[model samples]
Target: MGILNQAVQLAIMVGTIRTLSWPSANESRNANPPEKAVHRQIGSDFDYLMLTRIFPTAVCRADDDSVPDSCEIPTDTPEWSIHGLWPNFKNGSYPQFCDGSPRKFDSDLIKSIEGRLLRMWPNLYPAKTAHSFWKHEWEKHGTCSQNHKNLSSELLYFRTTMAIDTEYSVGSALERAGIIPRSEPYHLEDIRDGLMKELSHGMHVQLNCLTDKKTRQILLGDVRMCIDKSFQPIDCPRSNAFQPATYFTGHSAPLPSFKECPPLVTYLLETSTEPSHMLGLGHREFAYWINPLIPFYTGFFSQQKLKHELLWGITVPFMAVAIFIYVEGGRGG
Candidate 1:
């Protein structure tokens, strides 16, 4: 009886081992299944550029309205302040005349003008400084102040003495500097008046453009140009399915997670009216939805399903083992 019991036990052990070692049909098949549909790559470059560059520019330049006219230059000789070009000249004295001494121009006036320009065109020039030439006053007793005042007076004197036709000397200087053509009739007052009108009109237009959304498109274009110059184009994937799909099972089977795919078709249908400039933004939104967490959840659920199947497969064997133990113990007793 002892020998028979030992043989039975050995046979039971062998049977248990064989049953546990045998592979299920599903396991064998799944071990080397075909790749799943979820595998794909991500492409993002074009989308990013549109978001950061194109939209803002169009909005800024379309709204401006102010345009310049042809008047508004200072005609009478400008008064010099104590801190103006020639503070050393006797106050109200124009020495070249019987009782005339040069007066300095006001430093504060120039500074105010420069400040206005800087605010209007912040992108064009460097930030204004408190100590800029426009802000400095002529020293009352300094030789430098006297010299500056004298030089300015001399220019005014020369300009006043010259005939309107002889103003060509001014054009000669401008031509040599390559600013204007020598053949063009040079009228200092006319040029100065034109510049003032142009500046006023430009400021008005800029303000108008910034205020009106429709007109701001021009400003926005300028901004876009600047951004484009700063940014370089890079190669990126054309389609959403370029990234490889993640797998949950350690098995070589490539099963793509449907959840990981972007809803490109739905997005296209819904936002059919979206402009080409905004298409990339739309894609970015879609890509963000397909984040890494999505695949992780799919993998987790897959693992749970796999575990459930594995546990179910062993359930009958576990019950059989329990029943066999109960029977064997009863027989031994």
Candidate 2:
């Protein structure tokens, strides 16, 4: 009887997943944002937080790698570096805009670390306007953080994120584990193990695979590691990610592309010395998906004249049901 019931649920869910489609990036962006309000409670302190870092070079994107003349990137930055630090639930759903904290980013605070931010924290969408992106993140997620006291203030949020980035360079961690990028497929477990050495606190992390829905190719997007309130690593809690849309109308929920990756994937390296044609995957010049869950990120689904233009993930209400089927299908469902 239980199995029969699950089958019914799966049938409905798969149908919903099938209906999920992405509207244009402009449509999603131009969405009339919901009115803001003060958040009373989000949940007990997070099971773990993910400091997701992005690798610009690894993306099949066409953004000019050359730094603007006015700014400078470090000589030894990763192809991908810092994206943002996010508070998440073990189930994966998280709260957003927890408080009606004013949405303001301290210019002086960011200016203190401008060089690194210039190189590491890039806005993959617009050519060079990164300030807007930073502002978006703070208003949406930073203010929602439960550890605001430990975080102290807005400046503390950005500063502490940078500190985490400095301490854990996923690129450096993988290399130490003999996980070199720019080549053949590397097992997902191997990648996690490699990170284990540098990430001594716990092996609770998620590997994000950025798939080019257009190019039909996949590459690394961000590496998300789980941290506790005191900022220590903890075994990842099973993600029961919250749906922001139901609670906050007009607010799209943030979720990952895939919970786990295929058995094999290339870590990927950027070789500027070689022409893009000579290199595949990691070295191409194509745009990819916008992580909607990412604060301050407008979807990068807007296209360029690349060989493989991309679109964002189109998850409909039914899609969540479909995922439920996929996740529970084997459990007597």
Looking at model 2, report the run of 10 residues with the lowest lDDT sum.
247-256
Clashes of each: 42, 18
**Model 1: lDDT to the true structure:** 0.25
Candidate 1 residue-wise lDDT, 39-151, digit = tens:
11111011111001111112211212122211111222111001111111111111111112333333443343444323221221012232332222211111122222222
Error of 2 at 93 (Å): 3.0
Encode model 2's per-residue lDDT on 66-131: one tens digit a residue. Answer: 323211123455566666776654434454565533445555666776676666666544333667
On TM-score, the candidate that comes out on top is 2
Candidate 2 overall Cα lDDT vs. reference? 0.51
Provide the clash count, candidate 2.
Answer: 18
Each prediction's TM-score against the native? 0.13, 0.57
On the 0 to 100 scale, the lDDT of residue 182 in model 1 is 25
